[model samples]
Target: MLEALAQNLVYGILIGALYGLAAVGLSLVFGVTKFLNVSHGELLMLGGYASFWLFALWKVDPFISLPAAIIFLLVAGVVFYKLLFGRMVKLAEGDKIQNTLLVGFGLSLILQNLALQFWTADTRSITTAYSGAVFSFAGVRFPLVRVASLVIAFVLIVALQLFLRRTYTGKALRATVENWEAATLMGIDIQRVYLLSFVMGAALAGVAGALVAVGYSIEPAMGMSWTLKSLVVMVLGGLGSITGTFVGGIILGVTESATGFFLSLTYREVVGLVLFLLVLVFRPQGLFGVKEG
Candidate 1:
């Protein structure tokens, strides 16, 4: 029992880091653009497919293909915002939110169906030569790929944090997020900020997707579920708080691990929903979320 508990803890931490990365992307978009991106998971799906095709066809390593995936998704995100979300940004706040949600949902459905047509609903995975390599200490064994993914996630998160804190454009982004009108009056290019935010968010999702592809099976319909999960993580982390998102992901990872260990795999999702509901009821602002004006 003790050994099992130890194993689950390690698993939870590793998986939770990936969850944090995914949720951070959503939170970043929401924080800056106030767009509830329902199509975010599809970006992950695209990343998975990109990595898979690169590995299967060209024999490129998934890690090696990550930069290309990031760039592709970043460009795609900028185009999406410019073509779709940009037009609605001038609407009344409530109307803009509603429209963005609807548009995102429609985009998600379209992407999912397109993927189904192309990938045929069949599940796929990327299995490199060292995919099954493991590290063992005491009675615990950890997959090397998962460990690598966790490390990459942390590195990316730290890089993102630094970018948001130290760079000129990053400061401009924060200013825009705080008050677009004031930022515009101060000569900050609001359109550029929005484009950068959306692109960064999409790129983060792409990286997380690549990591996930290395460890899990990929399928056309796999994105929606991850989308929902990432949303839960976003809300739990308090909407726009990066630190909160990370903590929320860890909490979720631990909770899911405990549930799966004690009960059945089927009930693990239910517990996440329950946690989300409880947070909504007790603290709608989120665990670490601030009440933004």
Candidate 2:
């Protein structure tokens, strides 16, 4: 029983890393731009497809094809922001959130339909020669693909943290998140920061998608679920702290895993929602978020 529990815990941490990675993208965009891009999961879906095609056509390794996915999403982000989201950049906070939410919802529908039209509604996953390889330690099994994914996710999150803390542009982004008006007055280009944050968020989602394609499965209708997961982690981790948000993802993953193990697999999904509701009611600022004055 202990061994089985340990195995389940390992699996939970592995998937939780992905949850963190996906949520980070959404959190970053919302934190910096205050634009809740509801279409985040669709962007993630496209990323999975991008990696899938790269592998399907040229037999590219999913890990090796990660750059392609990132590039694809970055370009998509640019187009999305310039053509659609950019128009609402100057709106008041309330209007910006509302308009962007509606727009993002519409965009998600369009993307989902386009995917279904082009790719069909079938589920897809990447199965490499070594996909089944696993190592056991003290009676617990750890899948290599999932372990690699966790490493990659952690590295990316750390890289993002460093970029935000150490780079000039990243500092500008932080300043904007704190106060866009002040950032603008300080000669930071608000539009550019928004564009960069949105693009980066899309890229992160792409990475998460590619990982999912290799480790799990992808379909046209998977966007909403993933988006909700990200939202849950974002809220749990708090608003502005990347580290906190990543930890939140891990917590949700572990909770779901435990719930599935002790209760039933059917209860796994409900755990997140329950936690989300509890958090909202008791601590709207989130576990790591600062309470606004």
Candidate 3:
């Protein structure tokens, strides 16, 4: 019984890392742009498909294809910012946000249909040489791919933290998020910063998707569930808090794992709904979110 509990903890942590990675991009974009990219999940879908096809055709490993997914989504993200968000930013604040929502929702629909047309409704996954391989320690079992993904997620998160804390552009990004007008007065090109932040978010989502594709089944409609889950993590962590996002993911992972063990796998989504409600009723600002003045 103790060993099983330990295994559940390990599994939850592993899943939570990926969950955090998925949420970070959404959090960052919403923080800087004040616009929720509802199409964000489609970006994950694209990344998964990109990795899937690469592996299917060239025998490339999913990890090897991950960079390709990131690059592909990065370019798509920048283009999205330039075309849709760039124009939307020109509107009045309230109007801008509302319009962004409508446009993003439409974008998601379009992408989903496009994916269905191309990839069909068939589910897919990347099978690597190490797929299904397991590691055991102290009578506890760990999936090797999940462990690699967790380590990579941590490394990426730390790298992003350092970038935001130590780099010039990163500082500019934070400044812009705090006050775009002030940032612009200080000679920061707000549009460029926006582009960079949005692109970074997309890249993070893509990387997470690629990692997920190695371990799970992928399909055109799979993105919506992940997107919703990512949103939950972002809210749980506080809308724009990087550290908060990771912590939130960990909390969610453990909760869902415990629920699944004690109750059943079918109750997992119900647990998510419960968490959402609790957060909304008790602390809408989220665990890491700051209260609006």
Q: Pick the candidate with the highest TM-score.
A: 2
TM-score of each: 0.96, 0.98, 0.96
For model 3, the superposed segments whose C-alpha errors exceed 4 Å read 291-293
Candidate 2 ranges beyond 4 A from true positions: none
- Model 3 C-alpha lDDT versus the unseen true structure: 0.87
What ranking of all candidate models by TM-score puts the best one first?
Answer: 2, 1, 3
Model 2 per-residue lDDT at 278: 93
Clashing pairs in 1: none
Top model number, lDDT: 2
What are the per-residue Cα lDDT tens digits for candidate 1 across 1-293? 89998899889888888888888998888888888888899988888888888899999999899998899898889888888888887888799889999999998898899999987898899999999999998899899999999888888888888888999898888888788999899899887888888889899888888888888778888778778878888889896577789878888888899999999889988887898899899999999988876
- Decide which is better by lDDT, 1 or 2: 2
Q: Give the TM-score of candidate 1.
A: 0.96
Alpha-carbon RMSD to native, per candidate:
1.3, 0.9, 1.5
How much does candidate 2 score in TM-score?
A: 0.98
